[model samples]
Target: MNSSLLLSLAITGGLVLAAIVAYNTWTLRRNEPKKAQPPDPSAPSAPSAFGAAGMDPLLDPILRQEPSLDGDLAGSAGASPLEGLDRGQDPHDHAIDPSDALRMPAPAHMAERRPGLDPLIDVIATLTMEGVVSGDAALAAFPPTRRAGSKPFAIEGLNDATLTWETPAPGQRYRSFQAGVQLANRMGALNEIEFSEFVMKTQAFADAINAAPDFPDMLQEVARARELDQFAGDHDAQLLFVLRARQAAWSPGYLLQNAARVGFVAGSMPGRLVLPASTPGMPPVLTLGYDTQAALADDPEQSAIRDISLSLDVPQVHRSEQAFARLRDVGAALAQAMDGVLCDQNGQPLPAMAMDPIAADLELLYDQLDARDLSAGSVLARRLFS
Candidate 1:
């Protein structure tokens, strides 16, 4: 062996080793999951997941904090443009203020009544008092439990001064009272046994208030409950879309980071996030949930999550928000960002085509709800569905 041959072979071996290391590094980098960028305050807001068409401004990540409706209305409605004008000045000289234009009050039929038990969803028993009674007395006479079986039991007093029916409050006086039990809910329809219990509870309260109780026919009320329950069962729609990891499993932090990019905030429960509704105080438009155990683990960053679910409770959301469309977009956005596939509960891949039928059916359900006067997102609908 010559010295030249030995030197050439050693150099070649080194070059081959260097090539292998470079290739390995490239492969690892390419295969690694993508990282989400920290949100930038100065950057222009990203468009909707699919496109700008029909995008809700409420869902924009940059503008997630919506202005309060009351604040907007108060600033505009509280002031009259004609203010500060000199009393002696001619009113005709100034430009007509748009805000000063004549405003019409909502028609009686157009205005929704304050939240309370309704005959359409409750079995009411009227309690006619001989004279006005103290609210404190009525409160003391109330039933111990607020529920009869699965249905809610509530009592409202007719306020002597306000001329409105409301729950009895201290320091108020009532002319009459009414007790009601919800007719149906997710649990089931109110049965004969529950109706009897409601009557007994009402009668007891009436005796204490020195009122005459008038109960409805038991069979008729029970029958009404069944019909309502059947309608609810037929119309209720809870849609779920599962996102399954394609290659790399996600850590809770990684999953959360991507979810936050799409406007989901941490929910009250572990492993849950919610896309809030545009209307404050209403239920979330959508919910994103993953493995609770992973979220609870000591090192959530180390826990692997293979799948997460996005759900929408149809009747709970207003039709105007276009929640289903938002759900579809969010699901797609998450799936793409996480390198996952959207699937059904059974793990079947959910194609775009599969969603169209669901949307069509949803329209029909909304029409049915509107026709029945249990319009989706109304207080009554939320109560009945719950």
Candidate 2:
């Protein structure tokens, strides 16, 4: 009996100890943070990648609230004369302040140059002007083409990959959509020519701030961008031109007569476009530069997902080389400053400025531009240059 009692006691003790350990483990687990659950696939809605809708950067003075289209985008609603006119000033509503034009938008005005006109002119002029100065008559050989705006310029098979949305892990999948833009690194080298030109114009041995040592050299670039826009028939001309201007742009302050302007892009010129305030890590033109398209494939749930097909023309800078990686993303310094946001979403990304907009209203505006016929000298052109 004594032996049996001792055995039973031992067995009971062992069971009790195991029960304590098991209970403690259960308690600890119950108090621990629950594993992060995946987002329910059937949720009614999710916040936008930008976290909101109906956002606007600059409101029209009159309309007060509408999609803020870049003024120069042909059919932008509530847009001003310069809607799409950042790099180039609309000579129409914007009378080139005779003083501004005469003085030149060199380094002195650099500090004051906000988003419009100066950088655009500076970069494009930089890119094309040198050829003109060196007497590359081929650029001037452009036959007079009628008024054309916002046409698709063939990229000669840039072959940006098509993108599709991933149903699983949509957040990570969406992040990968940047591949198309990343692939556009091929254009970076093309911009080096522009920067070289910027350095020449700003640093050239011109005696005066505004003087273009090569007279028509600067103007030739504008003509080319315009011609490219007219003939090529896509936003690529404008976009590439902007990229070149922003990235390649440099001011020598080379040998200005004004001591203050000596190291400046000439006292007459403005310094540079300040990057807009960081809104969720986007620069202003990032939104402008990116075009959002629908995911190539539809979700069975029709999860209302879209892919943003963004092609960035980057020059080498920082580790940004890892992203686009063609050459140093040329104007990465400038791009570093731009902040972008998705202020709103259409059911589809078609007609998204830069992408396509699916919204009926936005689409109509896009259609108007698509159907728009610029008869060589359109109203906007005639009013300005004429």
lDDT of each: 0.72, 0.23
Per-prediction CA RMSD (Å): 16.0, 25.0
**C-alpha lDDT (0 to 100) for residue 210 of candidate 2:** 22
Q: Alpha carbon lDDT of residue 12, candidate 2?
A: 100
Q: Pick by lDDT: which candidate is best?
A: 1
**Tens-digit lDDT track of model 2 for 60-151:** 12312122221122111112111222223321222111111111111211111232112222222211121112112221322232111211
Off by over 4 Å in 2: 27-33, 39-43, 46-113, 116-386
Model 2: lDDT of residue 360: 26
Model 2 lDDT-worst window of ten: 177-186
